[model samples]
Target chain A: MKTICIMCPVGCSLNVYEKNGEVIVEGNSCPRGEAYGKTEFVNPSRVVTTTKRSGAFSYSLKTDKPVPKTMIFKVMEKIKKTPLKELDVGDVFIKNILKTGANIIVTGKLTI
Target chain B: MSSFYDVIVIGGGPSGMQAAIEAKKEGAKVLILECNDSLGGILNQCIHNGFGLRQFKEELTGPEFAYKQYSEVKKLKIPSVFGAYVTKIEGEKITALVRGKEKEYFSKAIVLATGARERTAGEIKLAGDRGAGIYTAGTAQKMINYYGKLSGKRVVILGSGDIGLIMARRMTLEGAKVLKILEIMPSSSGLRRNIRQCVEDFEIPLEFSHTVTRVVGRERVKGVYYAEVDENLKPKLETEKFLECDCLLLSVGLIPENTLLSEVEKNIKKQIIVNEFRQTSIKNLFISGNSLHIHDLADNASEEGAIAGRSAALFARGALEELGEEYEISFSSAISYTVPQRVSGCGSFKIFFRAKQNFLRKKIVVRCEGEEIASKFCVGITSGEMQEIEVESGKVKGPLTVSIE
Candidate 1:
């Protein structure tokens, strides 16, 4: 279990070893580092991003995909109790936030 | 009512949208302008995801690497303006202030990708007492990656660079509490995979030589003192320490905001010096990317905005040639400043640099008048990585150097 592929910028350096449930990987230079070492050895998930509060400010969001890693602090506490006075850059708001089915959206463009 | 152009970039970001899409793919007509009101810059709040690996080899994000060059400048419609805001330049004319009146335009060759800026916290003079939670790690990464705003719960970053280690894991994934980072230099001007995935996979703590020297709060923050420098960095006074924190980001350095050339000449870190096609030593004023240095990728500032949009499309069709002697490259002392620092015989080029320390295999070499031409061997070089090499055009005629040993 070495780890390093934070997905890109050639972070490389993987090395893992699991056997039985299966996983071998080693110093990967691509194959997306063997699917990021078999999903960081079974279930890493990530694509998070934050900011939800509304009224005076708070906009960014993201999660249309990659979620699990034990649901990043229960999806940042369900996007900090989801308070978004207005959404637009791809809306969605949270069709499945912590259930980890993903779908959070609004990756920019707000007006309130 | 004036607009005529041949090239006229001026900050649309990602090196003025890759120097107006490489000077409109060389046919030249180009425009760009952009003072923000859209058109990607700062890749719309840079949402993580490694960014176009090596110019679109996958791993995208930073607004899908700036919406794939703003959808190729809107499918080749090019001609941009977006809130303009120039306000004066003189030589090849420029004026600006577009949307609220004033205008002027003209162009023949002008790029100046006005980028870099972020030092504030009283430009690292920080003593303290002034109120409101302090910021400038790209304004707390645009107030939390484009307004998601959690801003502070405990924060206290202060610069290990790489946007204070990616905002100490984006303010600890929006929960806040970062606590330590410091770095008065001893290493980590960032990127070792951003100090290993944003501060050693979130264990945080960083430290290094240390710094921050006082910043308590008066209205919003509440504590943050710091110390432990030495080795010429000063501040050791019995190793101070304070830390209660409310928020204080400040990821230290970055300069070159290239205020439209200003009688040219700069490089005591105000950058704007250029040569070898990124031009600006006057001749139609080019200057690209982090205002001409400070480029650690955004695809090397879109390959120096496609070589200053093909040398401003051969200086707007006059065929741009002139360059035979002008050598003098020089370096050594492990190299730290060398972006076309002067090398015109004009043909083959490349020379990017960075590495004033952190070598593990060494050799780099290069030279010319002193003889030994080209050499390389490098390994783990680092100085926050940039390194590039390539030199031809009669293997540098006059003064050249560059060493690593």
Candidate 2:
């Protein structure tokens, strides 16, 4: 498996291959790169950031943590289609969004 | 009521926030005057990752990066006023319209962190009818990434700048189809990683040496007509082709919003002229962030803000030690322009610059009085991104010049 780690500006190219039943990673600068490669090759997840319409304006949101890559669209649809009220900054508006156990919280204020 | 402070920072974005933090750290009464409802500036709408790498060494979103500085301002208990419209600068005093009332502010020193704005459709001079569905790249990003609304289904983006590329990906992620991105220059003005992830990964076509010469549509955009350009980037009318796109996103460029400092706004290649300490021609008045020069990363802007803040604080307290013998910094033919065109003979400071064209594996050298003060080997040097050089304290004297060989 080959992928680019979008973790930081370094953008290290990772080549993950299984050898002798053990997954080996190369071209990583730090430990985070190794962890990123292994997790990405196995169960990939990402912290999604998007906007939600509320009244006349919109509020920016992010998943509390990384969610399954396969469930990203579902999470985005659930967030976009849902009706939102005025939110304070850091408000956890949606609980268990996408049933992925990740909550959607307001990273930007709508009430301001 | 009119209030007084030791330092007044205009435009409460990342630069203003960081400036306030540094000034407050110097034990001076500071006040931040922001025109927007919030203090983060454009960072609020930039929700994507890849910020704060140079500062925190952590990948944080735009809002998160702004929050880091905002939290510091809160902890310092600095006074700030949002929705304050700055009128103009009168000598050392500042005046603004705050809370629907005109208020005057007195400050010993002022820091102008008033960021930049996007160049619109008119600025680019597209020969076409004025119609709807025309948006600046930043405006569209704010609409989709911040407002949660996709303006159009099929889009043709002009300019392959960072914002344009970012929106190409954002619009695609939100289900809006981005037809293609057009650029007048043969190369992109954005980071290489952005080109790889935002455009290449998504399979979005970025056509170089091409530009939209005209736009079609009246009430709303129906399509855009673009053409291949010559070496001067002038469109060749014979090679024009029309592509049907519902929306036209202009990712052309950004210009500094230095309205209050218009009196002394002597720009060096479209950027404010400043000294080593981020001080402009007026000693007490310092400039930082995008207002000084268009920085590729926000962390650089924050760092400039801190320098301006500290310098302003020192100037205000009359404790600023003079670094005698100021020398003008010059650049070679390969360099576009250098920031802080003036430098002090003593103390260490960083100077930022851009290349005139693209080069691979080039040697960047900085010389002071014919002595090589600093040199570095760079890979993939492009005109779009900024290059920096750090001047070591007391390394050399007199006029400084930087060149790429």
Candidate 3:
């Protein structure tokens, strides 16, 4: 299978295949790209970044770790349903959200 | 309050904050004038990851990247005034409207990091009624990410800029149906990673060499008439087709916000001409970041801000020397434009530029008086991303020309 590595802005085209139950990735310029290709080909995941609103204000939030790609929309639904109050930057809004082992932390500062 | 300082940095965004931090480190009394009530500028609304890859050596969301810079500004004790809208700049003096009262500030040197503004729907001459659903990609990103308000239920995005591509995925994740993305150019202007992760991952339909010919709604955006374009970018009337969409987001180009210096200095491609030190033609004045030119990455802007900040501090301290001779930097038609339109007393300086089109396995050569001073081999280059090369300035006696072969 041919895929583009989304590890960074320097997108590298990768050729991934499994041989003898071991995954092999080619055409990657870096090790991170190889890992990304393997993981993407096996079970894709991504860090979900969005906003959570409190009263009259919104705070940017992101998953502390990458979640399964198939579960991204599910995470968004969970975030939308959860009502959040005033939170400081770096505060975790939800821990182990949906058993994904990723905590939703606030990234935007409320006040300077 | 009216006061005099050694350096005054405008904007207080990613670039502005870095400039102020560097200026303060140089032992100069610096003040930052920000129009927004808070710091971080546009980065606050950009909640996506992929930022800080070069600066912090780690992938972080836009807000997280901004928070790190804001934390540095706080640690440096850089004094900044929010809600200060600078109205005019005359020589070393600046007049701003602060809390509805006129305020004045005088500085020995100034750094202009006002950044860039999105090209609007009117600039593109879109034949449409003045409707409510039409919005620039940045505005829509702000509304949805910062205000938590969905822009529309169905959308048709025009232009494949990175912001537009990102928004397509954002709106889709928020449960809005992104109908399609239309691009006038033959290829997308956004990054390859974005095209892969944002559009292709979500299976969004992206059509190149296509554009919206006319808008089809009066009150709100009901749909749009689109068609394919030829080599000359002319839409074919016969090929026009309508797509039903409640919202139309435009991801067009950006223009530098250089209104204050519009009359003072001549501009090329709507960008203030600066030297290697990020100094403008006017002495004691430095420009950096997007206001100098649209940068693809915030990391590059922060690097330019550091140079401008250090230069402004040196000028304020009366340590900067006068230029003896300067050489003009020119580029071939195959290339777009080069930053630092001119250079003086160069000793291995980097020149950033973009290609006019895509090329594979090409050589970028910089020549001075027919002598090759620098060259680099690129595996693949595109007009969407900026490229840079280093040139040694020991024997440069005439104009330097950059070309791709």
Candidate 4:
């Protein structure tokens, strides 16, 4: 698989070849790219955003935690359980909601 | 018929919103005129994180940051006219040519928060067919962030600025293959945090001292050629190569949006030359945000915006005094340009600028009337970080010069 390294401003064109589920990378100009290539092919994580309900108004608790790339769908599911009663904007909803120990702060608010 | 208002804000971005909130705190009736369909000027479309770190003391996305300010503006009963396009601002009057399909209205003190627009591909001529695949990084980001549209499967981003670096990561996350980011300079122009969070973390290749010599494409985009540059920025031979690609995203730079201000004052290279209070050469009318000066972060813009707001209020109240003679800050070792080429007779002020290059340890000195008044040391200072120094406004009585040691 071919990818671009997003480590520095130098978006290096990287070549990743996976054999036996092990990732080998090349064409990267720095060591950071090697680590990114390994994690990208193995486990991908991302910072996710979504909304939580509380009464008629919906409060958004956008997570600042970088969750596993595979768990984005499941994390969204778990986020649905938390209600936004009395929640305000910029309010951190779940402290480590995904058990990633990454604090998720409220990013948006939907009100009438 | 004309309605009297205590304060009127033009834009709804973080700065404009903050200015409106501040002005309203003075117990004055405030109104915000937003040209866009909704509030939040550029912040509405900027879907990435890295905002409100200093002001809110927490990392917030652009929309999230905008939402916090919007909620305040909404709760404070800060009336806003959405889809209200402002046309002119002269003296104490502002003319906004508004139209919502046959309905037209005029409103009058304009904040002039109309933010700057991105310089398009047409301005920077890249050798190749001006095709569909070419786009500014901001445009591509709007497509993906708002409309959920992918620019292309393969891409080559030019200019190692923040937007380009962030888009490199964004495109990769969306399953698009980013070929590389070619920068004309020896070092990247983006922030260190962005370089770490967006580029380095994502394993994106950032080629320094390299530039796109030629772009190869017929209708869409086929590929691009890169080459190294010398000290004078002349393209060096024997270092040219081609990569296959379908898209080219240019994150060149932003020019201040000063179309309406043009009728009042002339432009010096497309930037409105303003006084200490951010008042353009013309009196009463003020410019802030990206319109006054291109800032590194929204934080600086907000700070300047609030000052402009206060100054506008003071002007409206006829409390403004004549500006003193201009004082210039000269760079010697590694200092870049400083704003407010002339300092007014104020008490306390902070100067903002960037370093010429990277340095481990350095001393910055401020000299006025051939006497050094302020001296400070720094650590790990790089061109990536904008340097802001606060000095007692009373320290410098006459013209001053700044030098780095």
**Which candidate number maximizes DockQ?**
3
lDDT of 2 by residue, B251-301 (tens): 999898887787774853556788888988777799999988888888989
Error of 3 at B243 (Å): 1.4
**Candidate 3, superposed: residue stretches over 4 Å from native:** B393-395
lDDT tens digits, residue span A56-98, model 1: 5445667877776667777878777766656666679879875
lDDT of every predicted structure (CA atoms):
0.77, 0.85, 0.89, 0.71
Native-to-model Cα distance after best TM-score fit, residue A8 in candidate 3, in Å: 1.2
Determine which window of 10 residues in candidate 3 chain B has minimal summed lDDT: B262-271
Q: Candidate 4 — which residues are off by over 4 angstroms?
A: A1-62, A68-112, B1-3, B100-109, B263-270, B322-333
What tens-digit string does per-residue lDDT give for candidate 3 at B1-405? 448999999988888888888999999999999998888888888899999998999998888888899999999888889899999888899999999999999999999999999999899999977667999999999888877788999999999999999999999999999999999998998998899889998999999999999998899888999999999999999999999889999999889888878554565456677888888988878888998899998888888888899889988998777756888899999998998888884555789999999899999998988998889999998888999998775856778999999
- DockQ of predicted model 2: 0.42
Model 4 accuracy (lDDT, Cα): 0.71
Residue-wise lDDT of candidate 4 within B1-405, one digit each (tens)?
234665677888877887787767755567777777677777755666767766777657777878878888888888887677776565656666556532223222346677777777778767767667889999998776555578888999999888888788778766688888888888878865567656766578889888887778878888888899999987786898888899999988888777777666544445565556666666667667877667777777887877767776666666665555656555565776665555764667766667888777788787888888887897556776677776786786777777778
- Please compute DockQ, using alpha carbons, for every candidate against the native two-chain complex: 0.14, 0.42, 0.69, 0.11
* TM-scores of all candidate predictions against the true structure: 0.36, 0.91, 0.97, 0.79
